[model samples]
Target: MTDGDLDATDPRTLPGFFDALADGKLLGGVCTDCGQVLLPPRPACYACGSRAVDVEPQSREGTVFSYTEVHTPPPAFAADAPYTVAVVELADGGRLLGRVAADYSDVAIGDSVELTVHEPTAAEREVALDYETDWPVHIFEPR
Candidate 1:
């Protein structure tokens, strides 16, 4: 699909995510009723079953919870294969999964890291997250 085809509404939609990314921010959802944090924020709380979720800014800081290096990605993301994918536990107790920009050999469980907003290049547009920024690609860097 073309960049123009990207949808920017609702966090669940790519377009909305990209809109935040273009602004260099990582947005997540929080349960207004229970104070539960949700990464990749949803409209409802998975824990308390509440629909009173609120948009909250997530901290870029986190620790590697788990990770794997994929030698092959699905057809669409084949180019990013052999890359490290990680589940990051944020400072606020939420978790998110994203690509680790660093070399897989350098990754370690529990490593400190911060969020980075990556800009979409033409080649990366297809699999680009809606949250990418116009600024430099954001990666979790060592603290």
Candidate 2:
């Protein structure tokens, strides 16, 4: 689905998540019941299944937990074919999935990475912008 605009105030949804991303911040939901941090920022905590949660900013620094190459992406993202997706473990203790912009050969487990926002090309913006700022996608790069 295409998300043209994001709401920065509501971190429990994708709109808020992307809103935070555009503002140069990564966000997570903290479980009030079990104290577990949700990287994707869900309304309910996955561990304890509690709705009592708090939204907070996440550290931009993270270690590469895992990675894989996407040789054939869906049509909407075919322009970014052969890109790499990596699971980064945030310094505060949670995992986040993000697209890696660097070469696949340059990425490795345990590599250091930092959150970065990427703007789509003019063609991409004209076709289908994912969010505000003419389609800004969240990504990570080797730091």
Candidate 3:
């Protein structure tokens, strides 16, 4: 779909991105102008301020760029506290932040990982807004 035709149902939008994720596909926005990759496809390129972005399939493989453990989470996620979260640099050049299946002590910079998607848990859905209840959760698994 063209940028001008973007809507909540468009892949460039969060809902659409998760919809594709639910089906096991990873989509990214490639900047036609500067080759920048946007992780959850957007209508415009953040690096070049260009609207010439195209949605395309992206590789699930990536390496840990950075990470941390959350010892204190919001009430909704208190049961899941002390989880590892990380910034992974994908094979296609897009960097995405997501939960890591490994523990903080097990993950390190440059560790290989692969993106994995799953339906949101009941607890997650409980905290999500109506429009986000159906969005899938993405995690990075050690590869």
Give me the candidate number with maximum TM-score.
Answer: 3
For model 2, name the residue pairs that clash.
none
TM-score of each: 0.76, 0.80, 0.95
Candidate 3 lDDT by residue in tens digits, 41-136: 988998989998889999999999999999989899899989999999999999999999988999899999999998999989999999998989
Candidate 3, residue 64: lDDT: 96
Assess each prediction's global lDDT (C-alpha) against the native.
0.74, 0.80, 0.92
For candidate 2, write residues 2-57 as lDDT tens digits: 33333555777876777677678788888888989998787778898787778888
Off by over 4 Å in 1: 1-14, 126-139
Question: Which run of 10 residues does model 1 get worst, by summed lDDT?
Answer: 1-10
lDDT of 1 at 36: 87
Cα displacement (Å) at residue 38, model 1:
1.5
- What is the full ranking by TM-score, best candidate first? 3, 2, 1
> Which residues of candidate 3, in runs, are more than 4 Å off?
none
Question: What is the lDDT for 92 in model 1?
Answer: 84
Q: Which runs of model 2 end up more than 4 angstroms from their true locations?
A: 1-8, 123-135
| Model 3: lDDT of residue 39 | 88
Highest lDDT: give the candidate number: 3
RMSD of 3: 1.7
> In model 3, what is the error at residue 31, expressed in angstroms?
0.6
